[model samples]
Target: MATKKLRRSAMLGRVVAATATLGLVAGLAACGSDSTSSNPTTDSPTASDISGELNILVSSADASDKAFGEVVDAFNAKYPNAKATLNSVPNDTYPTTKSAQLTAGKVDIFVVKTFREMPDYAVDSTSEDVQLAQSGGLLDLTDEAFMKNYTPSVLDSQAIGGRQFAVPTGNSYVTGLYYNKKIFADNGIEAPTTWTELQSAVSTLEGAGVTAFGIGGKDTWPAGLVMNGVVGGLYPTAADKQALTDSLWDQSASLDSGVPLEVLQKTQWVFDHAQKNFSGAGYDDMPAAFANGDFAILPDGTWNQPTIDTAVAGAFEYGYIPFPASDNAADNKYLNGKIELQLGVSAATKNKDAALAFLDLFSSKDVYTKFVATSGFSSAQPDIEQSEFLNSITDITSQFEPVWESIWIANANAGDAAAYPFNYPALKPLGSDDAAAAAAAANSAWTAAF
Candidate 1:
């Protein structure tokens, strides 16, 4: 916390704007479809060569759902006989759904987000992705030609045990709060950079007979997301977050006290001002509710912009800002992002060639550029022109700081409170217990493992 200013300065900068001309990557384009012609060349497969059913499963994020569809359509176009279909499951149920699909061998390509660092506590919570990769349930794409199309730095960040099992589709900043510009302009309130200012804005909105925040708490993760935003402000740097995690594991930290408890307090502030019965609100309905001016702010990730845009349909202008969960402005200056929507091929796929071909075509500059543009994700591939929405958020996104969820490893065997570390479900409005009770319960469960 003391070094936040230094950290912010170190991170503030422009995103790498690729100036290179768009063309087939010299070596990486060998397996990728020819950019100039759809017909086959000597170096590449013909339209009929790679033909089979290619089904991709990913957790639902409206923009990503469509961007993935772009790849499927392209694959179908290049290989007319090939059938590629995209299926999305809700985030809350994706794990079980993905596992069932993988067990049945119904999925070819699926989203993979795992703990690449593999912390000590991670063993209890090993993801299906990690297990698949470790046990060879995932197709190895380490030497794939299309893998060369991505930014090397992005690829390096995703590598597990010096190997790549998944392709990073694009990057996303998740700590953003989508606000109604019309509501703010009418209320004469600006984006808050500190907790005090955030409270002021909330009070003013309440005085104007408007709900301060709209959240989809029925799905559970949305309210939990506020704790994540608070964690970002509490610990701004990777070193700071990593140190906190180490402290927790080494018995030097307690969830009921210090920074961990602070995260819950700040998160509760958000829940306290949310629209009535938001705990019962469906995640799917928030976009339309926000567009109808039901609430002034919607805590969301950048990936939802395209969906919100469609829902808003010019009814009102909306803007996104990092959630201000701290008392210090510098701590809340930047949005934390993750190498999101990474995809990998299933080892059980009866059509491995088709899966590889889809990834090859999907990663090419020509196809990837349009994918990023429509997916509402920041370009993961270098030099792709950013969409207008991405450009609008450059002030906060110029430097990439990984989110708390990306940094901290949860203990699966721990109680709900110790598991997420914040335990938002135990707090009022969302639950019957208060912060103190929740934190105490967390300390109880957390200490049991040690």
Candidate 2:
């Protein structure tokens, strides 16, 4: 049972990470009497005026509890009168536990993955931060001084109708193709810049009897990484991608359309060429496999970097790049980027002053920087210097185009289809015809939902 629980936690973490990397729903327009239009600067209380026991809820899988524990300790030192406790829950139970706590008014603050997942706790509440502000379930922080420390664009992304409900923490670049430097060099293969080139490289590696790519297909979410990586490059622009999602939601888009079909085809290609028995492999197996030089590439996000490094003990070099999804260099240049985690205050907390103070401290330049740097995630605060691991991927990530997830995918009533394209199951067979049929079935389901 212990091993089973651990496996479930790992799977939950991968699913959450994948959603952070690939799932995005259009922001709902803010509505309700509680909407924050202007900065409520004067309403915020000073640190000394606040005092109470503050409880924070976060996932245990990513070492988030330890990182936030350090911040909580620092916060207590500044406001010695107030006490803060970190409640680290297993990733598999976080959402349900958070929801129960929120409904019971027992949680003072909580970690939010994306606005998209919030509605499950409060039916009338929308995932958009602004809508959340209007729902009266979250405290308005627009006027807070600490908010000014972040890049305006970063804060803006979390806003709904111009009211910020959450503070963005880490910048997540999902859908990266992490390659073994030594393996590629030994094969005389340069990083591919086009789909054709990528295919050629895969063939070359396969001919030499080396696994070209490593996948944890049994986990399901890892398989979707290929689809997410391809979709961004296929559309390559916010406007183009938005239009496609809109069409999809309205039943006007077809599975055979240029971008959708291509995404399905590429996903099938990857599955067909992955390491032996990939369908039975687990997520925890990939990093060790790649680190041991058993596979030339692993399709995943920066979240895996720490695990990969630990697995190899830094014995060989590895690098990341956006998956080259198209032959057109211009079209295949985007990365799927989003905030991996966020922090927000509960409106139901009796200790509102203490909650605000704690949030302020968490967002302070000193605390925020230390947390992000130590966690090895890219910072949302412009002034916080990113870790060396993040800096290494900046050249490719800097050129990222908007991913479709953040533009027009519907939440609220759309269910799982809102988070990921359901057609991915079809690609498990790794056949082009099977992929095409699955895409069509997914399109039909989406159309019915919309």
Q: By TM-score, who's the top model here?
A: 2
Candidate 1 Cα errors over 4 Å, as ranges? 1-73, 76-115, 131-157, 203-210, 280-285, 328-330, 337-340, 345-357, 373-378, 382-387, 398-400
Tens-digit lDDT string for candidate 1 (345-378):
7666777778877887888888998898877678
- What TM-score quantifies how close candidate 2 is to the native fold? 0.79
lDDT (Cα atoms) of all candidates against the true structure: 0.74, 0.67
Clashing pairs in 1: 18-383
Estimate the overall C-alpha local distance difference test score of candidate 2: 0.67
Q: Residues 1-450, candidate 2, lDDT per residue (tens digit)?
A: 001111223334544543442211112122112442324444445557767898888877555566788888987887777888889899778877876676566777888754643223222323333334555657777877778877675665566557777877667767689998888888888988788899999988988888898888886667777777788777776567766765665567766556787788788888888887787788888888888888899998777788888987878888887888888876766566666568877666667667777777777777887888776667776646676778776665554343445554443344332235536755654323466777776666555654
Give the per-residue Cα lDDT of candidate 2 at 354: 77
